[model samples]
Target: MSREPNQRLAALMAEAGASNKGLAKRVRETGLRHGRRVGTTHVTVQRWLNGGGIQPETASLVAEALSSKLQRRITPTDLGFPTAASSPVAVAPSYATSLPDTLDVLDRLAQQSLDDEQSSGVLLPESEVNSAVLSWLISHPDTLRVDVPAQRRVGMRDVAAIRTAGQMFMRLDFLYGGGHGHKALRHYFRQEVLPLLSASYSAKVGNALFGAATEISQLLGWTAYDTGNHALANRYLLSTLRLTKAIDDRMMGARILSNMSHQANYLGQISRATQLARAATEGGKGRATPRAMAMYAAHEARALSSAQDHTSAARAMNEAEKHLERADSAEDPDWLSYVDEAELVGEFCHCFRDLGRGPESLRYAERAVALTDPQYARTLGFCRMVLAQSQLLNGELEAAVTTAGLAVEGGDALQSARFQRYVSDFQRDVSSHAGVPAVQAFNTKVRDALADLDDE
Candidate 1:
């Protein structure tokens, strides 16, 4: 079938006084800045002008390039492209300034995510990540008057129930991965939690209610991340930050920033990841508990290592350890109770693994594995992958394969896309030693494991 010409794009280009070659050049330069290799040429521009469809990713690049040249926002729709809500490069939802507005956005996001299964594969744009982090860093508390007259009254008990349910879902996420109960969690939030936002409640109860909502938002973001719905994860995280701002909870704000940083790092936005992590540390400074601070610092170290800044990474790791040493679990919020010695060490293992510090990473990976409980299946699978990679970097090919096989076995029980990515990464790493019998056997095991997962 023939497609209509992108007349809107042509008009925009004419208005901006941009030539096909110039616009293509700008798109390539923009992609390079974002660490993407865009190969759009003037011929491709002509094809688009002739009503040829552009890929969602390239449409974003074109929109961005034109927006910069024209000094205005130009969306994909403006270029006559159908809106790609699930596109990895789609613009993110802007930060909301009011509590009701934030709740509206959250409700919409949940509904959209539930309706569209493709939301699971969307990537959060780098610009949106930076914008949300910066906004949270500078934002102040909005008025907390949530006592709207509703048929149902929201009390502390209602808030407590929300918290309890959120905690239960969180535990399930940690153990079986995000795919386990993600749909149920979203349903609970939409049906059970959002209604309370508009219900009548006292000032004290309102603040606590928003706080509880923030925790649930954060968990939703995390599980989305685990299940590979990165764009949806970012939306939830942005909402979480907005809720924190309404409650004036600096510690929660910092925690949300850290979560955003983790997603950034996972998506290869190293600079954005580092910036968000630094913001977390700064925002959490006098307000966060010792364990929380340690978690922030560990994430910073991980980003630094990815950037190949060995010295700064080590320094950040040491800072994290020092904070961990001072942490008292009794003072920690229930949400942060999980960050202990094992978690910090797991961060250490990742940092060293990224920096190619084989021996140190191997030791930390081993310790992390030993310290992690059996119930935390997802975390254990990740730790094992790190150990296997560490062994490979140390030239212990046989040991690496053996460890990798164990990791695959553990992964059999996980419903996480992140865990599968880890398995793929490990498989790629060991491919260099394909001649080895152990490596070959491990490859077979991974293939079988993935097949079983797909069948399920």
Candidate 2:
């Protein structure tokens, strides 16, 4: 069977400044380090680049050679080669059978996510996502290994450091968008968190440490989603689910499922989104606080609205509203702090908009805008955009233009690809009214703002 060229591998080679002959020689040297006399050459490298299949061991050698040159971890997956992670065996029944296996997967995924050159435009198949969710839902947690042989003996202080760093990264992500600080966050995870995971720790420390890791992994997934690296986001989320399960954080695991549902809805996998959201809601029954429960219900409403399940969607939205009214922040996980009134209103706006309830959408959108904190730039921008869309749908073209203009102004500061899509969507929605003075002006504003964003 003819295969497409390995653009991912080619991109990595370019980034490593490795020519065909040079990379082949490096691969051979790496093989020699493993007690193998591999006969790799420029021809072999060219063939590999041209979509010729490589042995798994040879692929590892290639990855090792690139990692040595780049001074960072490079797995076979990063080079678009089939690894245990991608193969049927790796993802077949579950994510992994042990804590170390989960860590291995997380390490490889973090490396792949950090390599923007390699991961750009790559989206994993929906089948893979389905498999991941299924595995998480059915698989039991592996045996926890708190006692590990390593240089450092970790404690609560170390776990607190990891949690603090993750919280800081989360704040930055919320404020400036994922593209703004994703690289630095990934570097922190690899440099700071990775060592802690490998260090000696008691069960107490391990639970706290893994909890922090779960938070970081979830943020990594969210940031990846914001930056349009959906496949990487999916991988990170799966790792997070594994971590949550290992730590026996049932509520946190439910939250991860809710996030997966949101991503699935965004990807147009309506059925899967609904299933995942329902799973989250059911699983969170006894474990989640009201605020966390609200989040799960809201995501379910989102998927239901997209699927046009009007009655079911309304029921879920009502449930979300009720939960939010009783939400006690102190009782909820720190990660769920962002899912406050404004966030719930935003979800309501989204559901109404998707359900074609323009008037209701406008109400929720306006409330979302009013309730949103200015520091949350991306959320405010999103609310404004939703308001503009609702206005346009309600035939208030001038009002739509004004709202869209504000969206452009606020959203342009964000480095998020999703925010850019919001701009594009509003622009497309308003393109029909281009003859109107306000619409034309808004169009001009969009053009200038997008140009500036591109230049930056």
Best by lDDT: 1
TM-score of each: 0.78, 0.79
Clashes of each: 2, 0
CA RMSD, predictions in order? 11.3, 10.2
lDDT of 1 by residue, 4-72 (tens): 788988998998898999999988986775568988999999999998877887787687677666543
Clashing pairs in 2: none
Supply the TM-score for candidate 1.
0.78
Q: What CA RMSD would candidate 2 show?
A: 10.2
lDDT of 2 by residue, 70-186 (tens): 544466777888653343212211344345446655665665644455455545566765676666667776445567554579899888888888888888887778877788887
